[model samples]
Structure formats: C-alpha cells, structure tokens
Target: MIENTSSVNRVAVAILIAACLFMLVPLAVAFVTATLDYPTFLRGGVTIIPGTHFFDNVIEVWQLTRLPRQIFNSFVTALGISLGKMFLAFTTAYALVFFRSRYTIFIYAAVLATIMLPLELMIVTLYQVTANIAEPVNWIANIGGLWARYFGDPLGLKLSLLDTYPGIILPQIATGGAILIMVQFMRTLPRDLARAATMDGASPLRFMFDVVLPLSKGPLIALTLFFFVDGWGKFMWPLIAASSPDMITGVVGLTRLDFGEEAAIPNYPLKMTGAFMVSIVPLVIIAVFQRRIVRGLTYMDR
Candidate 1:
C-alpha cells in the first residue's frame, strides 16, 4: 500500500503537463509553419498561428520531389531491418539462454561487447565491406599465395552491395541491445516451463515456437515498431550507401528539397511541409500502437 499526498499528486501532474508541452510545442510550431504559404511565411517567420496552405505546400512538394518513391524505399528498408533484427535477436537469445554450455556466457559477453561499438564508429570499414562483400572470400582463396602460384595471379572477386536494399538493411540488423533484452526476458521464465515441455516430449524448436514465441509476442511487437522507426529515420548510412536519389530513404530525400535560389530566401514552409510528410507514417504507427508499445516495453502483461 502507498500513500499519495494531494500536493505531491498536483505537482506531479503539473510536471507531466509541462513535459508534454515541451515536447509538443516544437512539433506544433513545425506543423503551423508547414501550413503557411511562402509569402505568409516570409512575412511572419515561424509563427505559432496556423495557415490554410498546408495542402498546397504538400501538393507542391509531392509534385516537385521524389518523396513518394523514397517513402516506399524507406518502408521496404525499415520492414526488412525490423524482421531481420527480430529473427536474429530471438534465435540468438534463445540459444544463449536455453542451451547451457561452458562457452555460453562467453558468447553472451561477446555479443554484449558489441553494444559499445556502434555502426557510426566503424562506418568507414563497414563501407569497405559493403563495397566488396567478396573481399573476405578472395583473401581466403589466395591465402599463403597458393591461388597466385596455381593460377599465375591472385584470386580476384567483386560483389558489391552498395545502393541495394540488402546493403542498407544488412549492416544494421545485428543489434546487441535487442539480444540483451530478449536474453534478460527469457531468463525470467520459470525453469518448470522447459521441464514441462521436455516431459511432453517436445523438441527444442517446438518449445521455442509454441511456448516462447507466444509469450514473446509483446516484446517482439514493441521491438518491431522501435526498429521500424529507427530504420525509417536513418539518414547518414542511407545517404552514403545510395548513390542515386531513387534509392535514398525518406529522411535523406527530405534534404534534397532546396528552395534557395540566387539572392532568394530559403523556403522554410515547404521544407517543414516535406518534414511533416516524411514523419507522418511513423507518427501514425506510434499513435496506433502506443498502448502495446508501453505494455511490451514494461512487460506489463507478463
């Protein structure tokens, strides 16, 4: 039992409202700015007052840019990344948790260590690997100059993933944080669950699919939405990986909107309009699944 003081409760409510306003005010301003026309925006820069030209700005951006195609690309990339990360994290966590061995802890530690080394820190090397995925194969084939002696030249193979969907999704799927979360969640399950499954003569894979998977549905859904949003918002890697405008993600595509001309003011309203358009999909997703996300993250159902 807990006692709640009325004063404390009122103070907490006030703080929550203030925090909400802090987050929402910027978004409100952006939406209001997006609603303004070029002339109106120029007259009153970044005003909180909403205008009627929101649809007009949206239409102009749609007509002038490749945002539609880029949005599709972002959806595909985000979907792939979400699915791939879930699969890898679930399977790896299952093995680490259920399969007892002397090396299990070591393996988990190794996976956990990767969290400190993010993709941004190793992007240059990652780019090289993506540029020629077959480089490792070529190196192994020519080890000790054996291939060179046999063929009179070293083995040369080239298989680049640059500008491809796999290139964008593959590098990002190996998430240690996801695996760590799954592992911790799985560890909380009763040992009797596994024992009962074994007594019922269920195989490892059967138990995982029928029991673990059902129990993990909430976390999986949460991670999927989380990863989808993360992938959708990716800018630097997508910009670097995709050489062509057609292959860029929506966030990267937004940077292509340039209304500045010779001695002309930059079109803030149109740029905000593009930002709003690019952000709507993920916003809708979060809005629809807000409860599930909260429950999943907190393991409230469990």
Candidate 2:
C-alpha cells in the first residue's frame, strides 16, 4: 500500500511539473521576444535583455496605429454581441430545460448542430449576406457623430458594412454557442427550484430574472470572461468583416507586422510588445474573476 501511494505521488508530481512548463513556455517566449533588441532580433530566437523601446513601441502602436480606437471599437462591439448572445442563451436554455414541448428535442438537437459547424467555413456566405443587408440600413443609421464612423455614407462612400462593427457583432450573436453552454449549465439545475418558484405564483420572466439569472452567476461570469477574451482576441472575423485599420482586433493588428512590406525583417519584438498590450484586458479579467469562476463551477457541481 505504501509503495503504491508513493508511485502515485511521483506520477502526480511529474504531471503537475509538465503541465506548469507547458503553460509557462508561451508566456516565457512572449516576454523574451517583447524585450529583445531590434537590431539583434533576427540573429536567431529568444533574447532576454528587456528592450528600452518598450514605451516607445507602445506609444507608436497606440498613437500611429490607432490601437486605442480599435480596442474601444472591439470592446463595444464585443460587449453588445456577448450581451445579446447571453440573453438569447439564457432564455433559450431556460425554455429548453424548464419547459416541455413536442419539438423540444428537435430544437435541442438543432442547437447542438451549430456547435459542429466551424465559423471559418461559413464566413464567405455570411459576409455576402451582411454586405447586402448593410447598405440601406447603414445609410439610415450613420447620420450622427460616431454613427458615421460605423454606418456613414456620403460622397459615394456607400456606408461600408464590410469590415465594420455591425458586421462582426451581428453574426456572432446568432451562432448560439454561448447559449448552448448556458443550456448545459441550466440542465444540471434542480427542476425542483423552478417548480417551487412556479408554485409560489412566480411568472416565467420573474423566475428567469430572480431564480435562474441569480443562480447562473457562475456560467455568466465564465461566459463573459470567455467572450471577452474571444472578442478581444478575434482575428479572422474582424479581418474579414472590418477592413479599416481603426476596426482591427488585437490579433489581426499584430499579424500585420509579419507582412514585412515596410520593414526589412520581421519585427518580432515590436509585434510581441503590441501583443502584450492587447493581452492586458483578458489577463485583468481572469485575475479578478477567476476565483468567482472556480466558485461558480463548484456550486454547479454541488
């Protein structure tokens, strides 16, 4: 028995150490790359001196590239999409889990099917549809201040919906992946609580807000964190949907460095610096709310 326990402990320690190294490697590379001297950056890989140009690089990226605007646009677009999806998810999950109907299984299956269809394969058709619809609607909405930035059309600008905020936010909300997650979380919820709420004369909306919404804090936080990261880090969709530099997501913007049209060699150091700047929000979100997420998961498990 003692020998078996010792073997298990050694295996656990080995696994833990390996996992820690796996997680730390990328971070180590990013940090090392972020601080490399520009001239010597191409010599090979991994330098550790911590660049003096960190602030200069950040300022240039922020001022010249309009990273701040991109960040803001991404935040607004992502928040709107995330909230919209969450609301849809919550209601759909609530109905699917709490209500019964002949078509319930069919509806559940249909929702599940969406998860299997990757977004990358669907972009071309999705973009065409978005572009077609955005014309008239875009014309109607861009009459005011920042509205023109997103939905404006004058002097034959034609109100570009392609590579714009609405273009990104609309399709994301309809996908229903987040809704599925919420639904899965909702399934484990005891049916008794909902029944009790109904017995106490609570209406559906009231119960959703009061009972389901309150209990769903964990999934909500987790989803929000996940969505925030997804929205913040999104590259391909933003690239496809929004062409303007001001609308670029962090991942997309960082990728532009490698095109190397202007520079002689790839500016890995600058690229890494920009990456770190973009990564700040997701890190902050995780740092602050990770405990809540763990707690929420624990609650759900119980």
Candidate 3:
C-alpha cells in the first residue's frame, strides 16, 4: 500500500508539471515573438530568440496599425455586450427561479437547445438582420451636426453604423448564455429569502435589486471579466462588421498583417507586438479577478 501511494504521488507530480508547461509554452512563444527583431524573426519562423527589439516592434504596430482606436472600439463594444448580458441574465434567472411554469421551462429549454447549435450556422441570418437595422444616428446627428461634418468629406472619412459600434454591440446583446448562467445561479439562492422579502412588502424589482444582485456579485463580476476579455479577443465578427480597417479592433489587426500586400512580408514581430498590446489589459484584469472568479465558481447551490 505504501509503495502504491508513493507511485501515485509521483505520477500526479509529473502530470502537474506537464500541465504547467502546456499552459506556459504558448505565452512564452508569444512573448519571444513580440520581443524579437524582423530579421531574427524571419530566420526563425514559428520560433523566437531573446533579443532587444521589443519596444521598437510595439511602436511600429501602434503607428502602422492604429492600435489605440482598435483597443478603444474593443472596450466600447465589450462594455455594451457585458452590460446587456448582465441585465438579461439576471432578469431571466430571476424569473425562472421565482416562477416555475411551462413558459419558464420552455425558455430554459430553448436556451439549452441553442448550446448545441454552431454559431457559424447563424452568421447569414445575423448579417441580414444587422444590415436591416440601419443604426440610429439621432444621438450624433442631433447634438453637434457631427454627422454631416463626418460624412461631408466622404473621400477620407467613412461614416455609418453598418460596420460600426452599434453593429457590434447590439448583436452580442441578444444572446442566451448570460441568461442561462443567471438562471442557474439564482436557483442556488434560497427561496425563503425571496419569500421573506415579499412578505416584508418588497416588490420583485426590489427583491432583485436589493437581495439577489448583491448575492450574485461573484458570478456577475466573473461574467463581466469574461465578456471584457472575449470582447478584446474578438476577431471574426468585428472583421465582418467593421467597414474600414481603422475602425477595426486590435484583434482583427493581427490577422490583417498576415495578408501583407506590399513589402511588409507578414512581420511576425510586429504581429505579436500588436497582439500583446491588445491582449495585456484583459489578461491583467483576469489575473486581478482570478480569486473572485474561482470563488464564484466554487459557490454551492445551497
């Protein structure tokens, strides 16, 4: 028995070491790629050497690719999606928890059903609906005559919400994952608490705002952080939705470098630098919120 236990422990240690390496290798590669020079990177394709051109590559990406604007767009779109997701999830979960009826079951079933459906299947319909929704410009057009000024010189400045902010924000909001998470979480909350709140003259809204939301902080924060990271990392949708390269987010900017039209030759160093610049904030946020996320996941339904 003693010998068997010792062997098991050794195996577990080996597995842990392998897992750690698997996780770190990609990050190490990306960092090395980001740090190397063009000549060095070209010679060592798919491999990286430690050297000094890190800052130069980063600056080149920023100047050539309009990385700042991409980051900004990413932030804006992520904020909108996360906010919409939070509200929808909270409300859906609340309803499912409080009102267990056929309709509720149907809604939950529908959401679960969507989980099996591939997102690629929905692209055509989504695109059509997106194109049909001509984004409302009342906010911009009304305030400062900005709309006319922006489009007056159409040669240089391209304007429209077709592949713009609204195009990105709205589509993300109509999803069901957030609602499903909220519903699952709300089920864990004691029914007695909601009932007590109701007995104490609290409306459903008050119960949710004052009672449920506070209890849900763990999951909510986790979801927000996830959405933020996902938004920053988003590439395909933004590439399709954004009309101009300038309006595209940093995630898409990385791919654009690969299809080098001129003498750019798909600079790996610059691509990695762009990726790092775009990805660092979301990574930092995940690291900072790592404890909270774990706590939220560990929470029991009791």
Q: Provide the TM-score for each candidate, comma-separated.
A: 0.93, 0.79, 0.81
Which stretches of candidate 2 lie above 4 Å from their native place? 1-3, 36-46, 134-160, 258-263, 297-302
Instruction: Give all candidates' CA lDDT scores.
Output: 0.91, 0.74, 0.75
Off by over 4 Å in 1: 1-11, 259-263
lDDT of 1 by residue, 5-82 (tens): 999989999999999999889889999999999888778788867999999999988888888889999999999999
Give model 2's TM-score versus the native structure: 0.79
Q: What is the lDDT of residue 71 in candidate 2?
A: 70
- Evaluated at residue 154, the lDDT of candidate 3 is 20
Overlapping backbone residue pairs in candidate 3 total 0
Query: In model 2, how many backbone clashes occur?
Result: 3
Highest lDDT among the candidates is held by which one?
Answer: 1
Candidate 2 local lDDT, 1-302, one digit each (tens): 43458888899999999998998788778877777756767775676555566676677667656566767776877787777777788788899989979999999889878888877889988787677775555555555544657545342334446767777887877655776777778878888998899899999899999998988887887676667667777677788887777777666766664423366667777777778887878788878877776665455522
lDDT by residue for model 3 (1-302), tens: 43458888899999999999998788889888889887777677666467788898877777766677878888888888888777777787788889788687877888768766645677776676577543244443545666657676322222435667888777666557777777777787788997899889999899889998889888888787777677667676777788686678777766666424366466777777887888888889888987776676556312
Worst 10 contiguous positions by lDDT, candidate 3:
152-161
> Which has the better TM-score: candidate 1, or candidate 3?
1
Query: What does the lDDT come to for candidate 1?
Result: 0.91
